[model samples]
Target: GAGVSQTPSNKVTEKGKYVELRCDPISGHTALYWYRQSLGQGPEFLIYFQGTGAADDSGLPNDRFFAVRPEGSVSTLKIQRTERGDSAVYLCASSPGLGLSGANVLTFGAGSRLTVL
Candidate 1:
């Protein structure tokens, strides 16, 4: 992919259902991040992966939320037992992960809009 790409631009589900959001990052980018944006707030970090391994996942609210980057290029965010409170736009971003510039330069996807009813 030339840029970060997220699937299911809009997803609406009832509470207690399971949901999965996918992200396809730019080719060769080794750093990927998952974020959540509520109705009126900036994006909040949920996880960061330096490669196939997750370097940080502290921002996840609980056990119900999980993400994985198998080949280091594509990622998936899984949410179990979804709740209305979980409604938000899930953002995916990727960077080069080469040096200091890697930490600052990010290409963001349009984001997956999750709406729990």
Candidate 2:
């Protein structure tokens, strides 16, 4: 896809289960980010990957959340021991690196809705 693409638009899982959400960013984009949005709340950054390495991951709530961009293009967000409170819409975004003016605009996907029962 020309834009960011996320798979399994919706997912329903039982508590204590694990889930993996996949994202494919636009070709040539070197910056990718993962975020989660709960009901009535804005999306919160989970991690940001520059190329094949994570540039920032301080937003991850805890060890239960993790993300990887192995090839610097496709990325995966992994959630372990899912809880009811963990249910939310996971969002993926990508940018073509910072502009000369230091502006970095992102293009976001439709998001992957996760529901824990």
Candidate 3:
């Protein structure tokens, strides 16, 4: 896809269930990011992958939240023991490798909205 793509645009689940959200990035993009946006808040960074490895994941709130980019092009965010507070829009973004001169703008997907019941 020309832009990032996220699956399961809407998910409704019970608390304590496990959920996996998938993100397919634009081909050839080397940097991918996962973020969560709650009501009345901006997207909060969850993780960033440079190639297949996680370059930064300090944004993850707890051990239950995990993200992986195993092959560099595709990434997934996994939430274990979901809670009502976990409900939010999971956003995926990607960009060409960062340049030395300045910051890079990321291309974002529509995001997957999760609602915990």
Q: Write the per-residue lDDT of candidate 2 for residues 38-76, one digit (tens) a residue.
A: 999999999999999999999999999999999989999
Model 1 worst lDDT window (10 residues) = 95-104
What are the per-residue Cα lDDT tens digits for candidate 3 across 53-109?
A: 999999999999999888889999999999999999999999988556355678999
Count of clashes in candidate 3: 0
In each prediction, how many residue pairs overlap at the backbone (N, C-alpha, C within less than 3 A)?
0, 0, 0
Q: In candidate 3, what residue range of length 10 has the lowest lDDT sum?
A: 96-105
**Residue 14 in model 2: lDDT:** 100
Worst 10 residues of 2 by lDDT: 96-105
Clashing pairs in 3: none
- Among residues 3 or more apart in sequence or in different chains, the pairs in candidate 1 whose N, CA or C atoms overlap within 3 Å are none
TM-scores, each model vs. reference: 0.95, 0.94, 0.95
Measured by TM-score, how close is model 3 to the native structure? 0.95
For candidate 1, lDDT tens digit of each residue in 5-105? Answer: 99999999999999999999999989999999999999999999999999999999999999999988899999999999999999999988945753659
Instruction: Select the stronger candidate by TM-score from 2 and 3.
Output: 3
Question: Highest lDDT: which candidate?
Answer: 1
The 0-to-1 C-alpha lDDT of every candidate, in the order given, reads: 0.94, 0.93, 0.93
